[model samples]
Target: GSRQGKDERTTSPSSNFLLSHLQSIIGSPSFPYSSNSPNSLSPLLFLLHSFLRICSIPTGRPIRMGNACGRGKRPAASRDTSARDNEPRVAVNENESDRERDEKPAVTPSPKASMKRSSTPPTGAMVTSRTRASTARRPSTNRSPNASRARDREKEREREKAKEREREKEEEEDDPIQKFITYALNKGVSGLRAEFEELRLKTIPTKEQCSVFHMVANAQKNRYKDVPCSDDSRVILKELSMGTDYIHGNFCGTPKNPKRFICTQGPLPTTIVDFWSMVWQEGSEFIVMLCNFNEMGKVKCAQYFPPTQKETFVAGNAVITCESVAKQKWPGEVTIRRFTLDRIDVNQKRTITHLHWESWPDRGVPPIDATIQKLLQMVCRSSKPAVVHCSAGIGRTGTTVSIQIVTELMDSGKSMETGLGPFLIKMRKQRAGSVQNDQQYVFIHRLLLERYMSEEEKENAKFVKFAKDYDSFMV
Candidate 1:
């Protein structure tokens, strides 16, 4: 008995020292084993069981190590609170049969056994691993390659459409012709008429201010007595020995080219000789007549040139002969006549091309056609200054001249701010009255719109069609 006591005392302290070391290692934060792992405490538990069996403890009794197993002590009444309390725990089982079973090499526990053994809540590593498994099984929210490419293509198409719209807007702004057409369409005919009236009411030179000297000195030369030429721009006949040096024509054009055209009244019976004399002296090679000799039973213009081919007429010292006649090359009542003018005194001869538009009435607009454009081309092609005429010289004459000037300005790509109003006001400085009425003014806008607008735009512009139907847009 004394020897047994000695062995007990010796083993007691050794067991206490081992238990203290094991408790410290398990409680450390850097412990490699998880409390929830099946094999985590197996080796330690086996060493403790062997030591306890050698100490003479009862084989059937369980050794409870209070908080040493990483769990706090609980009440005896609450010991059976969890379902795991009824099951045999690997940590506390000390029966001889269980000890013999544990003595063999540690076998990996089945999943069911591991689950039952881990009665406590899972550790951080275990929860992290379970979360990873769940994440791998979930459906992905990311798009596939084809779907991503389709979305990118849609965005690219939208960008291209935006760029196209910007390009069209730039074209509309840069092109003056398109700008004017858009303005006219938006304003419509009535608005254009009101705008023209407003422009006419602005500051312009009066008849008394414009024709001071010509009103008295050149009264009989003017076809209409009210229509007097400005002294500054009057066409003076060189042959002063035969008669007066005055003719009722004004030099009219843009500021760049002032002598581009000589706007005049149609020749009267008495002024026909002076007309031919003025034409011969000015070196004019083209004549644009905007009226017929007889209209509505009134003599609008004199039969100035000969009617038949090769017909000759003696007008003062100039021998005028008709060279050729091409009837109606234009769409309407238009005629082209070629004439040869021979100056007997100076012995100089020059050819003349006359384009007579007979359909345009007095104080009215002409038909919308290629007539004006064709005439503009012919006048521009001539090397010498051209003469343009209608009855009274300011109505159709001013409109035609204004159209030519604006066309040249447009073709040269010059920027204009307020459209043709400023140019017309400038022309009126040289001639007393130009663009005679509001109807004639709006007609110019319509003619330009007809010239430049596309067929699709014309179809879409309902106001343009409305104006055409209500107003006399055509001849």
Candidate 2:
């Protein structure tokens, strides 16, 4: 009996120590290592008492740690409770068992992305904040590649358009040099009649040159007397184009702000008055007689710069008037022909060569332009020299000059591959510091190319139809 008692004492004290340690962890009164309350016993003392009671129960009597209340249940938490009476239930062991059961087999857990997050109070705030911030600013995930590319292309197009406008501005400043180069290329060049590489066309004018007529001179000699302009109307040059376009200002610092249009108002717009006056001053030999010849005249421009001055036509830029009769030693004869577009009569009457600007055609304009083109072909067929003219004899004049150059390219058997660009460049050079607006230059080329291609289309259509018929017969 003494041995059993001794063993009981030793076991009881050890169990009390463990229970007291657990209750201390929860700050329960039953195991309070620290206590400021008067109603509570030290945790070690209560735990020791409970161990003694449990020991007694092994002898067959049951041990109850607390006094039996009206109902055998723990009291609710309150400030009045003594530490010993408020002992925690022994459910810690059951909670541990449940956690172990629910947990997955311990995996070598993936190293947490933010290695610093695993801690006692795992706030994980830095990592979470970083994740949230990145998610908040993520690029929109909704756009398709096509939409993105289209936006990029649109931006690129705008950039290109800006660059083109800048380049055109620079070009206006560089006009003189461009014009000089064009002149160098086109000087001593007549419409395709002379071989450039084979012969020096600069040699004195010949019978072949004689074969062609100078229609510009003819128009000058036969120009009607007068068509007075209204005193209120004025003219100005809005811009100078190199080949097809211009910057927004004039070469002379006068801002001739040109509006884009089809130029169907008259033979030429009044914006180029200064330019025309300058041309007139340069050549008195080319007399432009604006007159009222619209009714009987076959040419549209004839109404303004009529052909009454046909007798004044000469070989050069001088009137060669008998000033005091001493300067009349070298005499030049003038020949005049009526300008008309009657197919049979005009063709026969047109002995010399000519390309008439007044005879050319375009939409909303008289067929004079067409007649000009026809006269040009006839001149080429018969191989005659001709000249083209208009009222101011500059814009339409320049256009006719350009057309003749294209025909010359054709007649010389030279491919247009080497001609059109150089041709316009030359025409601009021929006219002092003149520029074709982008539309005008493009229109001229389009018209010529369209006509040229129409012939090709006719030929191609015939061949295609024949091939289809042959296939059908074979089937």
- Identify the candidate with maximal lDDT: 1
* lDDT tens per residue, model 2, 1-475: 2111111112244455554454444355443332434534445554555455455322231113221111223423223223333332221111244345335342223334333343322243344565556556656656768889999999999999999999988764454433332332342122211332222222222333222112232222212322111111112223332221111111110011111111111232222322222223222122212112242454434222223424332212222111111111111111223332112322321112111222222221222124436543443342212223344333444454455555445544443434345545433323321222322333344335434443544355433443343334323
Candidate 2 lowest-lDDT run of ten: 246-255
TM for candidate 2 is: 0.24
Error of 2 at 282 (Å): 17
TM-score for each predicted model, relative to the true structure:
0.64, 0.24
| Residue runs of model 2 more than 4 Å from their true location after superposition | 1-370, 378-385, 433-435, 454-475
Per-model CA lDDT versus the true structure: 0.70, 0.32
What is candidate 1's local distance difference test score? 0.70
Residue pairs that clash (backbone atoms under 3 angstroms), model 1? none
Model 2: lDDT of residue 93:
19
- Provide the lDDT at 259 for model 2: 17
lDDT for position 313 in model 1: 83
RMSD of every candidate to native, in Å, equals: 14.7, 23.8
* Candidate 1 residue lDDT tens string, 1-475: 2111111111244565565576567656577753544547745664674575467322222333433443333212213224432333333233335346546543446444554465332343244455556556655557767788999999999999999999999977998777666666777777767777877777355666655435465666667755556766777777662357777788886535768899988898878888887787778899999987888898889888887799998887888899999977556656888999998988989999988887887887877788888777877786567999988889999998988888778777766546676776777767767889877888888787778778778787565574574365443
Cα deviation of 435, candidate 1, in Å: 2.2
